[model samples]
Target: MDRNFARALSLVLKSEGGWSDNPADPGGATMKGVTLANFRRYVKADATKAELRRISDDQVAMVYRRFYWDAVAGALLPDGIDYAVFDFAVNSGPGRAAKYLQAVLGVVQDGRIGPATLAAAGAKPAGVVIDALCDARLAFLEKLPTWPSFGRGWSARVASVRRQALLISAAPLTTTVSVPSAPASADAVAPTAPPAGAGPHTGAEAPAAPPESVSPAKAAGILALIALALGALTAWAAHLPCNLLGVFCQ
Candidate 1:
């Protein structure tokens, strides 16, 4: 696992802080963002509310690193992207966070990060995916039923993540992908090259321009000409009966 991820994750854990039990929050009785239910599940020991009040920071960090970070494959992701995804997973869930990254990468949204996801993420620039993911996250948060009560805080958190992620990703080594010295084992399938026209087509020819518009005066003149032709036709039709007969009938 990337050591930098742990350092950055520490910052996120700090921001999340310790112990919140707002009635509006659905998590209910969260300590360091780990709810009472999760803590019980992770610890696997029955503890009273009084004991939960004494939950340590170290315990929280372990739960986050194992359940949240490892689940999302944070160590393999780009620096800024890992933090964004990790924090998002903590806020939302692992499945949603993985699916969100997949959505931005334009890959399968199976809610699990695997070979395909890692390959796509590594191939693309981190900034582009980070921007898109953050935008999508905000748009999603805006539609939630709880937005009226928690929208401001959610928006601020996303913004903070976006800014910090970008900053972390801006580091020289952050975006670099390392290649293995030896070939992969038999089970590993190497990433294939993208198909033709798969990447951005910068040199694509511009579309043909639309036909020019005619001025109002020019349009009126054309209409007048059509009217004159109709008038002449009418006059010819009116004289047809007289011309067909031996004498004038009109």
Candidate 2:
């Protein structure tokens, strides 16, 4: 395994959390985000619930590699993009995650990573590809029936993953051209001293993020509304409080 890929998988595991048996969770009896069914399928072990609970860290890693990382060809992707795609697969599925990457790259979204998708990814800068993928991910998640139930956490995860992917993409191999540092404001000045024990001050922040493309955001909003409309058809589902959904309630 590539060291960068190993590192990426480590971060994904951290984000996926540990065992969960929430009643609302579709993936029943997941340990470290590997569903029980998937665990059995990948490990070829007809392990009982108790045995699954005792699954080793090595087992979990292997399962992730087989089902998610390797399935998405994580080793072939650029640094930040690799982790973003891998994590999306873990949360969503490998097929959907692959489709999201394809959508971002303007490739045929057949939900399979083919030669064309790989070629497009190879040609694009990692930062650009990662940002677009995360945007697409958030859009797709907003369309899920579970969004009202899990949107807040899901949105936060997307945001965090996007930032991390950008950081990783910027780390090595690329020149300053990926993102040029903005010039300091002509009127900018060092801050005055703080209170006695306030400690040292920090420097200028990064330039504001470029304005978002309108189409994805608009499409995502429409899809989220469609999902919300359909959610009303279910007796078990209700409009979650906007705060819980990570939206402005008022």
Candidate 3:
């Protein structure tokens, strides 16, 4: 694997406390504390002592495989897919991560960590998820150094790897491209127009017809009609031919 890739893998593994000589035994550890031993057992529920040892070996190999290293031949990953797969494996376990990649790539979601699935893992080219994992690993490393004596070496290794991963992640493969400017042409220039009606254009809105003003005489005529109607009502009330008051009294 590339030195950078190896360094990154080592850092992640170290951050997780997977590289310790006195690695915790998975069999008796409680899940609550979540020591390396418990984590291994959580991933490999049915393995025996010998089998458990083998799981450790598998874990290392899976890490390399996902991160672009050939465990048997000792080769480095040649593509970003390996990095992504490695990250997913580290976060979700090899089996579950492979399954997710398969589902994302639309192959099969059998949860088997294999070459085809690893190949599919690279389908999403952007390294957002892997970068996120790297960030997490860095944070874990920063805190690991303050942990108890038993974790010192592991913590140191994690811290080292975290620094390396950050460096690698910093040098992104993709770059942003600026939009090209159009050439200045005579046709592109907007023409200047003369002010208002001075040129062939008139920018002013036409004057609206003045609202018909009500004359005082027209208003007085309406008032006079109303007054006349009121006067006729008063005359009727004062004893007209109908004589309503006289009839009521009778």
Candidate 4:
């Protein structure tokens, strides 16, 4: 197992708790965070509800690893980043988790974690990425039909995930466990503060982020497209057959 895998899973389990068969929950039944359907697919093809309830630690670990961790390519991701994406994957689907990760990185949202996505992620500070991703997660969860029923626990989980992810990102990892989180309300949400032991906020604040990188290829392609459009317009205005850019000027 990767070093961070165990740490991340441990934190997630706290929010999952024992056995839950809440009818309102679409997951139906979950044990140690693994839904029965997933358990059946992974551990036992014909697994019964009884088997899911009796799911062991080892089985839980396997399901998480194959379905969640590997799906997000967690091993290649940075410390806290891996946990953030991993938790989101467990709660949401891995594809959505990957897309969320991509969205925050400002890369193409292809719903797959690959080299381009990793490059974009590594360019930004992990803390910033985690905060952005958590904010996006909360925004999305609030839109769900079930939000009225389960929003509180989801909020709490997001808040806890954001804080703990930041902790592990900065080197010397904390042994302290994290609870689920977000905010009870806009007025009630406590802002995430700097980690302990950092002295008062002195000195000038960091400068604004630099501009997006220039893409010569994209620029060239766009310029070519513009030229084609211009040519098509000229052809149309002149009442000639339109051939430029496949723009039909009948």
Best prediction by lDDT: 4
TM-score for each of the candidates: 0.67, 0.66, 0.31, 0.68
Clashing pairs in 2: none
What is the overall TM-score of model 3 with all chains considered together? 0.31
Candidate ranking under TM-score, highest first, comes to 4, 1, 2, 3
Which of the two, 3 or 4, has more lDDT? 4
* lDDT by residue for model 3 (1-250), tens: 3444565465455445423234443324222222335445445565444444344544654445533233211123224434444544554355654554455566777865456654544344435434444445445435643445434554455345334544454455545668999886644543454366553424443345569999999999999999999999997676654574356431
lDDT winner, 1 or 3: 1
Model 4 per-residue lDDT at 115 = 94
* Candidate 1, 1-250: lDDT as tens digits: 3666666677677667777888989888887788788788786478655666688877777778888899999998887889889989988889999999999999999999999999999898989889999999899889989999989988989999889888888876656788978864655543455467665424443345579999999999999999999999999988887788867674
How far in Å is the alpha carbon of 82 misplaced in model 3? 2.7
On TM-score, the stronger of 1 and 3 is: 1
lDDT of 4 by residue, 89-171 (tens): 99999999999999899889989899999888888999999999999999999999999999999999999999989988976
> How high a TM-score does candidate 2 get?
0.66
**TM-score of candidate 1 on Cα atoms, chains taken together:** 0.67
Clashes of each: 0, 0, 3, 10
| Candidate 4 displacement at residue 47 in angstroms | 0.7
Compared with the true structure, all predictions reach lDDT values of: 0.83, 0.82, 0.48, 0.89
Per-residue error (Å), model 3, residue 44 = 17
